[model samples]
Target chain A: MSARPAAIATLLDLPKPYLLFLGDTREPGYAKTAFGLRDWAPELCIGEFALTEDTVSTGLKRLSPAAAYAQGARAVVIGVANYGGVILPSWLDSLVEALASGLDIISGMHSPLSSVPALREAADRHGRRLIDVRKPPASIPVATGARRTGRRLLTVGTDCALGKKYTALSLTREFAARGVDAEFRATGQTGILIAGRGIPMDAVVADFEAGAAELLSPDAAADHWDIIEGQGSLFHPAFAAVSLGLLHGSQPDIVVVCHQPGRTTMSGLPDYPVPSLEDTIDMTLRLGRRTNPSIRCAGISLNTAHLDEAERRQAFDIAERSLGLPAADPMRPGAALDALVDSCLRAN
Target chain B: MSARPAAIATLLDLPKPYLLFLGDTREPGYAKTAFGLRDWAPELCIGEFALTEDTVSTGLKRLSPAAAYAQGARAVVIGVANYGGVILPSWLDSLVEALASGLDIISGMHSPLSSVPALREAADRHGRRLIDVRKPPASIPVATGARRTGRRLLTVGTDCALGKKYTALSLTREFAARGVDAEFRATGQTGILIAGRGIPMDAVVADFEAGAAELLSPDAAADHWDIIEGQGSLFHPAFAAVSLGLLHGSQPDIVVVCHQPGRTTMSGLPDYPVPSLEDTIDMTLRLGRRTNPSIRCAGISLNTAHLDEAERRQAFDIAERSLGLPAADPMRPGAALDALVDSCLRAN
Candidate 1:
């Protein structure tokens, strides 16, 4: 009864590993999810707040001012922290303002600068701190393990809560089961994931400015583009927002999309889908145009668990012949993608 | 800035579905997950206020009374209308005490009970008007479509948000694609989801007593057991609690569970997955034992898109061999089940 996560303490312990939720429901869901998180890590109360204007500014300030105030807190307001991301300056601006107003903001952005231009401006304007999400794309981290012996290619998911982490974890397990050199690299928020090798530690969102810079990378190290996966559907706004942010941020070489089954589709409204191979290729091309006109989308991939081998092959064929891009399975993305990444990595 | 949900409403209007949760964080993730239920239906602003002995009773009263007074004295406090099973009395006692303290009490239960023995006792002890939440399970009323025609099986997941609904929807789609008859029935909270059925009567949970009765036997023509799908996970106390209540209140033929994937891993602690298949079959069998020690579980089902085919086949095979029962895929439980239900209906 006494050991509780109080509002005051939670707020004071701001700037912890947190999540920036966009939709109102997702924010509350985080609260609901706290029980499980707490069970996993009692010290973790990962703060939950809506990513609305006032929440970003005032509510967050009241909830968790900053790590600076973590000591003076009367009670723990939240269990932990996690900053959700869209890789946009406008969004990061609000988060930074929240942080500037005293709430440490952190996230996994491909290219922080590419997404949020003003974040850098904000960090400079008011002495606000930033966190590096991860190192540059070309040098994606290689988890020290039976490392990929060859052109090690890794991928990640789009968001924090989405099944991306699990996807990466599973992919790693699957890879290990097959005596293949591989590792997992987390990327983006709930609906996004990135699994790669050789990413530097600094890339893990050192601060908001760096995250902003990484998100808005103009050249978007496509060569270093860490192949990322998404947690929610391809249609989730966070997915779209952050996915596009990664596109503009790293301009990935080959985008591998992971889709889990069991999504709601009551209305035609956003039942965000796991990216179809075709859809992934299409988005790659589309995003390539939007992020950089000169960049051509290399290829796409899908989870392929829901489909049978025949259906899975058909999906890949559709991606290859129709979409004119290579496709791979999440469990085991074959040689096609490896060759492409090699070609891209080797090309001038 | 004004677009923030909380900023727009004075915690009273709570433009979002704000649920001021007041309970122990250890109350199993079920109680907490109700907050996430707000996500599946995004129109509401869901808020949570975790509690202990202090807040669950007195502290909770303070918020509701204050909120009611501020908002012109209209308050709707929701809790398990009747926890029923073996642990029913004390819960009713606590609920009654809270109800007596002055404020409209909403019996937010999704079951039909014969009678709340404890409520009747508490009502006698302290005269109070009880309010019941009448919101229909949103899935009902709308025309979902026709059931897929199929002979294959479906494996229900462990709980909510994990992927049961997705499995249901996708399995239905998968069945249709393969020319099979399939439908998803989400039985929990709203009672049942007869997806795509012409008799599209949405699941609307009425009074616990009423809900119990209907669920036990929808009509004079109903039976003691019918193929049922329970939403949320077995671990979720609220769901488990309610399901237990319903099991005793109105036991169904067989209960199929649905669950989603965990957002993250429990870092230090070890997670022993319930062998997916074995745990589910055992649980279902245990449920059967309640009615009759001799009554055995017919089968087990799983609902997850994350596992690859190899994993799925392994999972299915495990269920068949260990559980020593057939696989039950909610997606396409064929005519045998239908015949059993028909026979039950005829007998009733």
Candidate 2:
């Protein structure tokens, strides 16, 4: 839209010390963004802010829009998950007022903030900006299924919010530590912002999702590793289409299964229980191998954030013994990830 | 951009003796449209026209736009296959002249003719309407994984243009003959035009492809079956994303595998050879079972049109023995299809 964004932009360059809107639906997606930003671009992120009528601690200092703007916050970043449906938030009027008061707005919701006529008019009137970070770039062609060069690893998951982005970023860091050239290919908004560039796979035209992947890793050398962040899950009923498209499009030679030890049900579907880790591994292997028969699961990235120290250690042990591959919680320091990187490098 | 269309539109009322544009790219898609129009709406079609400089007999009365308009031709229906690239046809000027001369145009190319500025300007100046039949409708929501009430079946292919639409149509007719209420759910332009209503599944945004399918079959009695037409093959390099999205979105209770006998390469990607029928079946089962573990491949639809009578019979026999399923060419009269319909009906 604006001379086409660079493959990635420097988020830290944006006017920051920002306000993150996490409304009433504060799930792990919201948590991941808050934590990932602090880790990746702490200088830009000021603090967390919620729009709920009742007070809720996000484990960070909270601020109202007016208070945030008064304290050097020039932008508001919305990470709300409940943007679907026609229900507008009670705090929306005040948020629109904040847009009119000259604070730039950034949203990662599927529902574009530009769609709100009142907010659009307010932003225009105030000469402020509204950035829908989830919107994919225009005019990506249908995938040609061109043979991909270089080594690639994709992080898949047993469910949404199961540490796919964290695993990919971790792997990329490990590859970097090993002095191997690697880049984190983000597929969602938070990851995109963290990595400074990647396609919003869910926002793309269905036909071009794979093409976006192909374009992202165009003509890599045999030694380079493109560690791609996968979205959704094969078991995620609401979003498996996105997951499958990314999996096939990325055409990874090696895959890492990211899982949470304490989860029993799918992210949103309570009626649908999460499949066993072995089955998830099996499905990933089966689906990924459709395009690349050489695809193998190099390791497991366990998300033990919700588990205690004892439970977390048990998860790592169970995952390692059952899958017989390197397994570790990506959020914590572990040797399993380093082993995975070594194996993938050796295989390549 | 206008009011949402009904699930199906009655094309019988359109001005008759229509001109069908085959153009130079007469692959399987073109041939299917030509023969399908003859079978479904013969009275509406007057002639076929190709825009090749070389002499090519299309076995129909060749008429120029002015010449066709001199007769009873009131519209031009395009089914060309070479619409992906930026190259316009050599005869495009004359075709636009026809559009300016008041011939309403209908195109099924992935490239939207409306996007061509000159043609759009000409059509606007002349008050002639241009209809892109493959454009997906306005915003469709992400699938809610709603519990569907009626039975549904989807026909997947081993490659593009391998008789997915034909198999679904055949199954719909078989159900009709058995006094069962059923509808053929089209997901592409030709099938949409033939059935009088359906989504252009490939043209949809990636997130909403499955939503389109979910929206197509809202609710029906247990006895009513919705036979859905699938697009692209699971192994197709260029279009597998569409195939996977449709499969997940349709959430079919039963699946049908469509294949072409003696075809060695993918329809477009010659470098990518078609997998063995056994492998295709296994892949379909593996993917489809992700959504519905109860999902079963009910039958196989063989496109033996390229084979002689003896060869066709041999092809069907090989498919039946190898897959252990009833297999037949939908274009030919056979009990295999009837058996499939009966099995699905009984299963429902």
Candidate 3:
């Protein structure tokens, strides 16, 4: 628990007033980091930048690195995650230009920004920093399984990139709005950038996954809530271990099962189908009980962005009826989101 | 599957005919590496060396580094896993002495053999290799969960360091003796050291645990059996994620449940009690079915070293009667071990 503050402090030391770089990604799904910062931490994001005219925008005013630097942007955050998480060769020029413009480079890519020779050299010559958010902190201890004093709510998914982070961020805001002591605990890169601190769950060594999770949400006041953003689904073939380790380490008193209704297959893994919401809740509780025996499902959070207004309501109704839990799209704040938040904060 | 040969080739390139270094450890448990090599690959071992006069011995003839090198030992293997897997400062002189004696150093510790300045400088000066078995291979893919050609058996545990590796090794040997095309798949450092190749499961990135497991036991002939070593307990708060990922990735047709009969708590976490054999088998099969729908428990392998002969027999009888699974201590090499191996090989 003592390690939590130090880790958080180090993670939060990233240069602020960022100019989000969307690269050439046309799909909004690829620009999750930019969108996340815009939606969650708009004050910290000065503007958006991109190489191509056809690229999707975060709706912020577009600015060049030099322009953004003049406008108080301290860094250029790589806001798009592409396949393989590699930095494209085509994007190197813009990155080096940013370094030369007196703005630091920040990236959440699988490959480090410093790994690109041009970016590293320009940063070195310009005395700018290249921060890779995916690199986990050194010296995480193994999970102790000793119960912490706080209440935790974890957002688990039925697949990857389907709103686990959104649900967590929404819930933390809702809880805080209601006067509960709540903090958003990030576990992935996008969420880390938005929250200003977190352990990159997937980047850590397998042995320390749970330990890192434990460190992320250390003991707090009994009434405080740590809304932990989850990574991967329990049924996801490739990433379930990350999900399970996070679940066990967080030892959440309440869990919000997040799912995308129209997702036929697990993300990036077409061979495996997405698990049913019922099965997800059942399995999460069963496995999560290994650490927190009294763990219970608080509600269901749906990524109903694909559905029409009528269809969203219908889906929510069906989920609430079948699962006997409040269901809502946290992205669409309303009575449904309120009900879901209320369900989470309710005493067992 | 393409990565398996290359990984194995790289891992098996370590120098052989080793002198086992037991350091100053008095506990036999800490000397597991020395004993594992002695038990599994006796011919590869030249002799054992220890710093203290009254330290527990592997019963191999005591020899100094120079003397073992004279007898054709090419390397000095650090054969003890201490509290932190560290190359202790007190043992630095001996490690440097080994390098000066013209033997390469192989270590399976958490801390790399090359991390110690003296060891690194001495190895460099002597032009000898310093191999660290705990470091995982680079470029592991995310797991696909696609069924492969080979039949596989994985030995899972109720706790860490309770004989999962030994059980898998024993079963492989028995299967080989019976003319089955079986290979021991190592997942931990000691197992890697014994089998000459393995993915250090705990040392891998959390996201790649399952992928590494998949790589470890790749598609083989339909008749081939890859007896995969397991890591950690599914009920273990700290490491269940590793166990789960390995279980899902291994996708074993048959599973052997490994346990220590008299153990009350988890290996290091005393707050949690050991899971029951029935619970371990049930949970393993249930979650393992995600990747492997037809996964089934084969039998039980017990670490009965602490129990007397009478207690061991009674415990085996009770477990078999209660769970309807064959139970045996694989280290004992008798009728019970035969029964357990037979159960594992039987058609599921």
Candidate 4:
């Protein structure tokens, strides 16, 4: 056979580069890549260049639907910006034309390309792989205080600032203390375009019941069990919807509700921190049972710093009675938390 | 008071009418702008018709430069074809020029302006705010799953795959079950660049630990915890490293370690899902302790699909004897899981 068909020939006979990189200087991710270049793929041949009308046009010129096949670069991953907020057609056409030229194209957009019709069209095309980088939080190991795979935190929040970072940090530290590793996955943000992505609604509900089982189950790391929190509650409908949807899919080990008892005027919720203990527990319990009747809840991690000594105590006790867990706050000494968690494990 | 200085903007300021509405388009955000039609602060505005070929003739244009703001609009938000990658200068410059007349500009890039010197220089000279959306997963909320959010998954191994939509979907489901509304923050195909921004050497290891924490943590929605994976153990080190670093900054609660025991390999440890008994508890304790040492662990979720009945039972027995908790494979019957978890919780 005289080398078979070109596409077939290349498919059968080709030694592609183990590494090649293309990035744009238009975003933070561009430099972010530079930080860990040696780690992502040390051996791959990488190329970093500015993307301009000239550069993009030039990059496209450099590729050939057929030639790329010959030279052996089968994939092209295009990174786009998110804060910019919208995807423009003219901007995408330049890349899409080249994508048509035969390379396996992976388009990475930081936001949902709901506004960009060109993007949607190109994505609809065959042989084109469109990946929204904004679909999930990149998961990895980290430590709040100690070390070991301590805690796996699903970072959630009402708006961008409910001390999501703080809560995640506190929990990680707690888990680390017990010699467990923690992985943080940021789930929701205020700006739906930037932080939130729609996942199936049905799947989210299932994870709730799973959460209870996880808490009651034995942990492989330390002697006790665990906890998980979504970013929002029913109070914050959009994110709560997403959080709920996710539960349906994950079937989490157990579910825990974290929120300041007070309310906040912004984002259309009660004050960020509820002033009353009874309200907090009532809300937590009410929200906890939405997914599964079997789903058990780990007591709240009273964000005590936000409240005074009395309010904190009241909140702790209230949450304890409502959720059937021990009184615990992250910032305080761990003995109580340990005891509370231990008892819960034992009692279950 | 020179109009109190136009609250300069970028593409985000573009009027809804200029946008050629297509298949499914809605600026839920734009609809909610507090500023009236003169809604044009001029700082942020994105428009292709506004920026001509002349904008690209020069090097880079300042979309919302303090010195040169948009002509008519006082404020605007920059837009970029910043899908998963960065934007071209031709496009960026055009966006920059959209803002003129001395309005406070916000430099929006696919990554961070700091990623490249040119963008930084523009931001510095123009007194524009540089927002790094890539490093910090954007906090935008949008319902785009099903028809809203599309699916594209490529498993380049574990670390890379963790950034996939499926993982986010699982997280969303987990949260939903808890009735803690959560949304998917689609960072979309986070490459080594944004994903590995500040990772340390032990990133890969962190991811593995994270997996375990998710499984073991009693809290179904592991939003409180951060990372559960061990360092230096992920399929992609950058993902592990950056994930941990990001979480370190964000600070999560606890971590769960998902252990896979097999042949001795990468970390000089046996595979977690191995056939032997000690493989379960021994590997978990080591992994958990190494990742973090503060937070508590829930339990382990066994990947029993890889093991035969006897092997699974032996593994389960080992876990029970060693860790004193229930075991589960994400694939087990619900009753089996509930009964096991119930017993484990009651076993105090």
Winning candidate number (TM-score): 3
- lDDT per residue as tens, model 4, A165-217: 34444554566566655432323221111111222121121112122222212
Question: Looking at the true structure's interface, with contacts defined as alpha carbon pairs within 8 Å between chains A and B, what fraction does model 2 recover?
Answer: 0.42
| lDDT by residue (tens digit), candidate 3, B200-219 | 88888989888888888888
For each candidate, what TM-score against the reference? 0.25, 0.77, 0.88, 0.29
User: Per-residue lDDT for B1-348 in model 4, tens only?
Assistant: 111233321111212211110111123332221121112211222222324322221112333333232344333333322334343455446334432333332222334456656656665776654443233222212211111111111111122221123322333344345454443322221211112121121211211212212221223342321122222222221122222222222112222234443333323222221223333233223222222323233444454567787887786677667766665543554543444434322211
Q: What is the lDDT of residue A270 in candidate 2?
A: 79
Q: Please, what are the lDDT tens digits per residue for candidate 2 over residues A19-131?
A: 76666654665355556666765656666677664533445667777777888888887644552522154657766867765578876665677777778888888898877
User: Each model's fnat?
Assistant: 0.00, 0.42, 0.66, 0.00
Q: List the residue pairs that clash in candidate 3.
A: none
Report the lDDT tens digits of candidate 2 across residue range B241-304: 6787788777788888888888898876777788888888787777777567778888788888
Residue B77 local lDDT, model 2:
75
DockQ by candidate, in order: 0.01, 0.31, 0.49, 0.01
Colliding pairs, model 2: A206-B206, B8-B197, B9-B196
Error of 1 at A223 (Å): 7.5
Q: B316 in model 1: Cα distance from truth in Å?
A: 68
Pick the DockQ winner: 3
Task: Give the best candidate by lDDT.
Answer: 3
Per-residue alpha-carbon lDDT of model 1 for A240-315, expressed as tens digits? Answer: 2223333333433334444333333312324333334444445444533422334444334455677787887776
* Candidate 2 local lDDT, residue A197: 59
The TM-score of candidate 2's chain A against the true chain A comes to: 0.73
